[model samples]
Target: MRRRVPNEVGIAAVVVLVAIVLSVLSPNFRTIENAQVLLLNGAVIAFLALGQTFVLLTGGIDLSTGSNIALTGMIAALATSAGLPWYVAVIAAIAIGLVVGSLNGSLIAYLKLPPFIVTFATFGVAASIPLILTGASSVNVRDPFFAIIGRGALFGIPMPVVLVAVAAIVFSVVLRFTSTGVHIYAVGGNAETSRLAGVRSARVIVLAYALSGLCAAMGGLIVTSRLMVGYPSAGSGNELFYSIAAAVVGGVSLFGGIGSIGGALLGAMLIATVSNGMNVIGVESYWQPLVIGVIILVGVVLDTHRRRISLATLLSRFRGPREAAAAAPTS
Candidate 1:
């Protein structure tokens, strides 16, 4: 039998190939400083992608993550301006994310609502809250310590990058080794079957969305800390798009129950690298989205193809036994 290569290996190779091409095309793209900047810029998307992975694993999507970032950041800024300690503000922001995620999960899991509708409604609501609360104005963050979360470095790596790395590691372990993680995969693979097998599908779904919300909150913190302000329009741009694109490109199946945190991170890095390289090479800003859209379409097509092939292979394996038994003179 021929060995099949992992999806991650293929994506990683593509990332390296793209990086090499960019390095050759643009002298500045090869610099260490540029590399650090690229990683830093990609950190927020990475966080969102990580969170999306959990939700996606359960055959669900969270469109509210980008809006969650805006809402959470605004909340943190407002809390800071109202004389709350930085840590307190952080907690407040994270708490809001949990609440929103829980709400989304509850509606989908208990009410049997579609994940798309629930999260899309959440997206609108979360996005609107920041604008309404701040009256469409940016809230300034006066706490200097709050900046550390975004700007501080550990062992020469950017703080955001370090934080994402830590998060990826922790989550990777949990998904691979924990019962909750197994439940998440089972739920995503087949919710009805999992439920019949005694898995708490509803609870698993809720936890997935909650984890996604937590990740969005972390992204919000980094963005707010770096800017030292809570702009009501924050995360209203390409963040949500880029996050989904990154996850898809990283081998996460849109249908659910497939993908890894490591692959998602690689996908994030590829996106960041492409964006930065384009900027360095003077590609028009308007064209960047076009390129990313193409990437997304390709990822989706590939995912579908892989699924079909796997399904066919499984069917053939099952048929092999039946066909051989029938041909054995009814033995």
Candidate 2:
């Protein structure tokens, strides 16, 4: 039997190779300060990708997560400015995420709405709410303690980085070791079959979207805290794109039910490195999207090919035994 290497190992190798090449090309890329900055900037994308992993595992998508950041972050900023305790404000923001996520889940899971349509509609709604509330202005976060969530460090690591690291570990464990994880994969693999086999596909789907919403809220907090302002346009830009790209590039299938937290994290690192390396090398910012788009296209193509190969192999196995039995000559 041939041993197969995990996709994560290949992605990790690519990350290391890229880092080495960038360091050699750009002296500044090798500095500790640059490394810290890269990680900090990548934190938001990593968090979004983590949540996206859960949803993707359940054969779903979350177009609203980017807008959810703007909505939740603005809410937190407003609550704090209105004299609520920072903790309370944070809680309120998270609650809003849960509500939005639940709404998305209910529509898709219970109402049988398409995931794309539901999330796309909510994306517009979520993005619009913050803009309307602020009258197209950014809200300043006056609470000093709020800064810790994004800027404060623990044992020399940036707070956002530390938070994401913890989240990744927890989510990885949940996906790898829990029965809920099995249900999630089952639902993604074949929703109808899973339902027939006694799995509550609807509930599992809702949970996945809800978790994605929670992660979006966390991303909102970090971005708002780092800037000390809740920009109405926060996360409305490249965030959603980067998140999807990271997950797909990390080996998460577009068809779902096949991916890992570690792989997504490595994908995030690869993206962050490319973005940072480009900036360091003085490449025009306009070219960044082009590069990322190519990466995404390549990932999708590979995923499609892999799926085809797996299907072919499975068909061969199923036909092999039947063919052998037929050749045995029945009495």
Candidate 3:
């Protein structure tokens, strides 16, 4: 039997408490307009976190997510500006993501390069690609279909939020019921064991990075659509940290093989809530990063503690009756 951790519940509690506190402290925080802003902005982080979840589950990290977004956004924008159809531009963006992901995966999985080093190198290349392609300029997106994807609402709910929810549902189902998903967990849990069990760790790792890239590209498209422009430095490095933090905070293990897409969604929402609450309560913009950092520190500590407890519980459950009895206190 697998041992359970309380990280998910803890995160949910924190989110509820923060939302209640923010609502009490600032009337504006409870308004529909503010809610819309929070969800719409949060959708991008949620998408990025979902991708990060996949990589982290495979015992790896992708530092190039922000760069992937920049490059892919520029690709989409440039394609559209060149008289290509909007769908073609969208496909171009995803293709860029897949190609970049493949590069990261191939080097790490096949070449036996360290994930951090490979992704870090790719991060520089991917980030600079947009600058080189556009000479560091922004491109406006004017296609009505593409524009609506970013700005439209369904039944009064923002499209980005809806899209994110749909994606989350699909991913959750895939991770829970599919053979590939099982392979992902197996690979992350124990690569040697998984290989002995006939799982192809290299292919799975590559696919995970590819999915990460695809998600990054989607996030980039949403951001571009919102602003209606593809800025060379659109995502910046901040998003990379946010996506990782969200995955970690939402119960995704940094050590790998233990997380859910639903948890990642909650983590993303918590991040968005914190940022929104701080703004509504009049915190200085510059101080927001400090607040986020503190939250991440607390989350990491809690996760470590949870893992320890889970380990202890599992060990106790496996001990023989006499051994367990001998170890127990006799008050």
Clashing pairs in 2: none
**Which candidate, 1 or 3, would have the higher lDDT against the true structure?**
1
lDDT of 1 by residue, 1-331 (tens): 9997888998899999999999999999999888878887899999999999999999999999999999999999999999999999999999999999889988999999999999999999999999999899999997889998999988878899999999999999999999988998999888889999999998999999999999999999999999999998889877888888899999999999999999999999888889999998889999988989998899999989989999999999999999998889842
Which stretches of model 3 miss by more than 4 angstroms?
Answer: 1-7, 321-331
Instruction: Report residue 175 deviation for candidate 1 (angstroms).
Output: 0.6
Residue pair clashes in candidate 3: none
TM-score of 1: 0.97
Give the true-structure RMSD of model 1.
Answer: 1.2
Model 3 scores worst on lDDT over the 10 consecutive residues at 141-150
* TM-score of every candidate relative to the true structure: 0.97, 0.98, 0.93
Q: Cα deviation in Å at residue 143, candidate 2? A: 1.0
Q: Residue 39 in candidate 1 has what lDDT?
A: 85
Backbone clash tally (model 3):
0
